[model samples]
Target: MTPLGRRLLILFTAVLLLAGLGTGVVLHAAARADRADQPQSGGPAVSTGKLTLGQKGRLAFVNGAAGPHRTAVASVPSTDPRGGRTASDLKCARFYAATGTGVCLQSVTGVLKQSNRALLLDRNLRTLRTFPLAGTPSRARVSPSGRFVAWTVFVSGESYSSAFFSTRTSILDTRTMRLTPSLESFSVVLDGKPYHASDINFWGVTFAKDDDTFYATLNTANRTYLIRGSLSRHTVTTLIQNVECPSLSPDGTRVAFKKRVLSGATLWHEYVLDLTTLHETALAERHSVDDQAAWLDDHTVAYALPANGKVGSSDLWSVPADGKGAPRLLIAGASSPAPS
Candidate 1:
């Protein structure tokens, strides 16, 4: 063969190879996009619609189902949690609503770092205000009267399962627009004495009917404590040890919290603490739950557990607050239960 013919053949072969590689890349990208748009098999049906915190007898949460509505603030009838879900346009990583107010934590990718923020929403699900967050959002709650909102974020490590991590918790009064940037500034009373430490961290705040009273998990010296706090006094007092993510009951007489089952392990079991007697009752849920539980009513508490055979998703379950009944599935492919 002549030299000119050989050179032309080589050039043609290279062009064909590059074209094939480019086509493959495009196909792979398209396939990923399609998967994200499609719903997971056996996932609950969700439709886009208007959702409101003031809707009577409704339960709201962050939709974890894989579909177009994934991560959107979704709601189901409190009486029919297994029924179809109505998703709103607002998306959040964590959310909670009470009375007529909602708090939504969201993250946005930026050029240099991920930007996190919290949106205060009205009864109509409209954004009333936005507050910048210092890190990745983990937990959120609103007071029963809908006057106060609180959120927790991990400033260092992302997971509670990690051996070392730092958190920043903030509370805001919607009526006056007063903000408490971090709970660490509150005076601490540990074991009936004033305490101070650089390692103190607070998270998973749950408020009582009285706006001034709240409960949260306080961690320091490799131990966790349930602390009762007062907004007016700017003070916190340790109540019990080994308690995390306390959720006050609707009646404000009890708190549902996750108790660490194994030392130095991430396993935890749900328990109900009677505020009057300081008695703790182990709940019927045997599975290790790692969520801040929410009260469905005065007698029931709902929380999230990892969905079976699904990654990055969870299912909401409820059991009797008295520790007598078994856990019942409240909602599939959902997290952050906020019942009203």
Candidate 2:
């Protein structure tokens, strides 16, 4: 199909799903009903014991084995392990835990092009409320104070290449229950000049300690730029180039992101950029990491790597933020690691 035709097809699919006109819902409901007897994997839904609230060294991640239809939010002691615990009630594609609260993007009905929901829950994994979302769920994160929530979804676009996809990122204010439809709605300035481009797209938002300031990847003119933005002002200004999926450190002094390195144009090497000095430090993880890393603490960064080079199975690994220590396994069969 032509690129225009491909885009139209994708748009039509989204329109049908959003308009509540897809049969996928009925199929999904039946599948869920059938699996009611068999619980989703990752462990039992037992009490987490003194770990109800996020701990400084504990980590919360999504279990990879738990299929897209129903997944579990698993938790384990970061530096120490008492045992394993899973929140069976929390069936989400992506999740982020912070400050005794969490935000999750869950597929409510279907497997692939299904209707999705954004859930806000307390430390115990109890849902406070949910917002219906559009597009395929990708990533979800909460601010340091758990006051702001942000998410990204992949949507169909006008690209003839089969790999072409567009991203839709949204933010929600938990205090007021206000939602921004898309980050694309905000104005962006490049190189101190007011800039507007039709092809502008954004993803992978990492918030600062202030909760109002954030850094995200902005794609325009066929180049990726790291743009710093403010929720209060709704404006993004370019900070640097070629950085994707920036993860701000706990102290807000540095950002870890994926930088392309190989000639194949697909390999992404992880690197940390010091926000104050603008100096970049290459991490020790030699393998191509395609995840937005989470800070295990002020000194460590944790991310997911495919198990045995297989995409279906992923294991969480941690490396020193200062590039001093070797990567070590933190958790097995996990993706989307969020350190508390």
Candidate 3:
């Protein structure tokens, strides 16, 4: 053959091989997505239905099961959390509700970057308002009186375990339609004296029933502190150290939080802090819990742990608030426990 013909033949062969590899990768990805839509063997049964935030004695969560209903807001009877689930059409990455009001954090893929938003939902799971988010959603909560909402997002790094990340926490008054775009704008009082820093970040806001008081995690100087915030005063004061993701109890007497088990480590153990006495009680769950817990009632606290043998899924587990009992499985294939 001529030298030019030989060179052409080699180039054509290389192009065909590259095309075949690209097709194979596309097919593999499509197959995985197809599998995700099908129901897994022995998974919990879920049905389409109207789910309301005002439904008394029901537990709502983001469904993590593999099926068409995956990522939908689902509910099971609080008395029988293991029973079949009724899933709503609304889907969210994180959700929380109180007194007929709900906050849903959602992410939508765009052509260039992912868009994130928060939806203020009514009792029937209808969108009452929508607020654009600055980054990826991380946490969400509604005040017990249903008059306030708050959420947090990671503005820089994706994971809290990363050494370098920034967060933006926002608060909204549902009745007045007033919004506090960032908690960093509020005045800070660290260890009695006024404090400020460029590296400060706040997240995981849990509100009190009073509608003006809230608690959140404040991070600065490589240390985490629990800060009690007031909406009326536009200020936050440091309460204690090393507390993250504070979830206040039903009666507002204690806060369920995850404390770092060691310095400079991502591991955490859940503990309850007495607001009056300033004492802490470690819960019975021995495994590292990385979620902001939800109070099941005055006596119990619930949180999600990664599901066994399942990727990108979690299960809800509950333990006594007094720190004496073993962790009990509350629901399978679920996360973001919201007890109504």
Candidate 4:
């Protein structure tokens, strides 16, 4: 399909869900019914990725995940104000907030041969400048300290004629722009191989509270797992497995990610795993709802999900930390959810 055709197809599907003209309500009712076997509660009926009581939230997402991708930096107020205003938009890629205010971010631009670029945008979304990366890097995430930046790159050998994939993971000091040398035949990771994997990989990195340690989402073999590592040691251990997303809790004892179950392509559910025990507990299940999870507090986890996956059919929602209440909608059809 053409790029515009694909985009319109995506948007049209989004519209159907938002209008409740799809199976969104039925799916949600079934999910809530499933929770009867779990727990029950009477809290907020709906909590948005958008704030409703002066408690603003931050979510950096590519508004259009399809072709002609446009990076959108959005902040939702405590109140349902204007359906969460867009703070800024970048050249044509995904973005992550470097500062709490969404200042520094890394992005990709089809305009530059899909070259990886670092960006600094003012509060109004004006382009301050763009820094090209050493090699074409992938997505980016800001460190917990808000001072350093970390991203993954596949130091692979793929060309027009040679179409094989073996990507090595790399990190950069966003403040310094210094990249750790590639792992040479197990240079950093001694026990396992470097981050060389087949295609259809979805690896993302995150830092610990100290900004010295890292965590990533790796899909290998037939199962997916979350791995934790340190930049200083360059060694990784399987923190937990059979899960994706790999977002760290503020306290660092729990991880919120989308755990695949049943038929993975049919269902993706939100889960929070205890780091020490590796025990996973489910939150909610809605098709096409995995990708991002944000911790609101030690007991609350917020996420973005599609109320419906039809035309214009996705919405943001959150489930309780204890799995006691039904999943509640926060907003409609958002791709990313970041809690402050």
Candidate 5:
């Protein structure tokens, strides 16, 4: 072979090798991101099982790691608690404002297929009653008046996710002690017409002041919808698109939700939808929020932001609902923030 040909062959081989190494780096980074998006399993349990109060203007949320088993509910003081006693086996909890009542959902086993239960709790996070349920727990909420409670669980073979993780959302009327097994039974209307799809799944329920009306997210036909539902009619009507995890504001005038925007890298931006005018104002939060936001007051919204993309590393953050202020960190190593 000519000397020039031999040199060109060596140069071409080197180029190929460099290209292969670059591809490998990209693939490795992609794998790491996927793993980070998954929920973390088996962390060290909470050492202190104490349940604090929001009465001192503090926030109450699922301690997530506060019991003997580590999957428990906990509270953070707006100020230090004067005296308190801890509770064990919390699993999960959500408190309503000023009602001294909340709902706690717990899975007996960490397995997704195992049975779960919802417990009615008093102000101090002590269980008053328990109801058995199916599926792995996900979200829990209580009405503003504490007259109603709702919970969502992931059910296999029913969800429309590419991973097949569907949801079974249920509601309980504490006043009548009536539990609706699933929201799937409710009728849905889309585009001014009746829409029925077996793949329909609902989650992220936030109730209104009257306790008779609520807002939730419904995923169907490979799209997400913000739905306005009524407890009296047992039906849901689609209001807008690309919205999920609806959280009603404290004043009942607005709803804070995640708006899915697909441009370059699909992003979920926090947006507040004015109920009266049906308008949306995107907040200043730039990170992807996979949580149903909690209202801190009439003007502020708090939610869990997963740190480094890992679900277990969620941190609590607050932002102005009107899309004016910058995001501020409220608590570290905490999630599912519920203000008192």
Candidate 6:
């Protein structure tokens, strides 16, 4: 063959090989994402092996759909004492808000394919659409504007621990139920043990009003901190740390989070930190309760207290942001609460 013909043949072969490999990679990624996104259900199916036969998962008490009447509702199974790792047959309950015609969610258990799920309900506790998650959802949060939803999940690897690896975070359109994959494969140096996703992991997910940027929590060898990232930039930067369960304020200036207190011999307290000063102040102390907290507004925050009066069995409670007002028990003794 002529010299030109030989070179042409080699170039054609290389191009064909690269094109084939690229096509394969694209197809494989799409297939895996599709499989992960398929609607599969499982959660604390039957409170048998781990929990008491009918243990409540989580509860949320909100204003009724009508006027003046208050409603107390619980998630289908309500409480997941076993944490996120033991989700199987779900018992998500459905209820509608008694006020403002706003949508809502209760407790349902059993999640096999997805990690985090938000149950939508009507005022009377009626089940509506079940939100299925893709990849491994970590920090699931309703947008600060309440117009969107976002979650951080394990995207590529199965390493759900404190290790420097890649992870994917998803933002969903509540109005359309459409998921937009934003930041994927962001890595942080986690100098710690092989920590599970639920263990010492990032559960602090909050969105800004503009919905362009959001925050997430991640635990490292030393301390747990918050990270701010934008979909446009596809990057994350540390905002604050030495804390967990961060709930950002509505106005977007302050972030309310529970400071890390030693969970040993005797430790159960709530701490709020100032984002600007990086100062942490104690908010409340429950001798036996250690649960997640959320913010209702600038002055109001919701928290959970164990129901057993000792350990386990958590109920929802609301208190002032500055920790001055008397804490009010809202959902009696139940577990889990997600805004609709």
Return the top candidate by lDDT: 3
Candidate 2 lDDT over 178-286, as tens digits, reads 9998999898999899998887878889898897999999988778889999999999999988898899998899999988785336788889999988889999898
Better of 4 and 6 by lDDT: 4
lDDT for 283 in candidate 6 is 65
**Ten residues in sequence with the least summed lDDT for candidate 5:** 79-88
Candidate 1 scores a C-alpha RMSD against the true structure in Å of 1.7
Clashes of each: 0, 0, 0, 21, 5, 52
Worst 10 residues of 4 by lDDT: 44-53
Shift of residue 69 alpha carbon in model 4, Å: 13
lDDT of 6 by residue, 18-46 (tens): 99999999999988777653322442222
Give candidate 6 misplaced runs (Cα > 4 Å).
1-139, 151-169, 175-184, 187-201, 263-268, 309-312, 336-340
Q: Which candidate is the best by TM-score?
A: 1
lDDT of 4 by residue, 238-282 (tens): 655676657778788888777667743535678778888878887
What stretches of model 2 exceed 4 Å from their correct place?
1-51, 55-57, 65-70, 81-83, 108-113, 157-163, 309-311
How does each model score on TM-score? 0.95, 0.80, 0.91, 0.62, 0.76, 0.53
- Range of the 10 consecutive residues with the lowest summed lDDT in candidate 2: 42-51
Residue lDDT tens for model 5, 65-123? 32233334556554432123232456563333337777777666555655578888877
Q: Write model 1 residue lDDT over 1-340, tens digit each, in one string.
A: 8999999999999999999999999999999999988887777889998887868888889999899999999999887888899999999999999888999999989899899999999998899899999999999999989999999999999888997899999999999999999999999999999999999999999998889999999999999999999999999999999999999988889999999999988899999999899999999999999999998889998999999998888999999999997999989899998877
Worst 10 residues of 3 by lDDT: 36-45
Provide the overall lDDT of each model, using Cα atoms, as 2-decimal numbers.
Answer: 0.93, 0.79, 0.95, 0.53, 0.75, 0.50
- Clash list (residue pairs), candidate 5: 50-86, 58-78, 63-73, 63-74, 159-166
Ranking by lDDT: 3, 1, 2, 5, 4, 6
- Prediction 1 global C-alpha lDDT: 0.93
Model 1, C-alpha of 76: deviation from truth (Å): 1.3
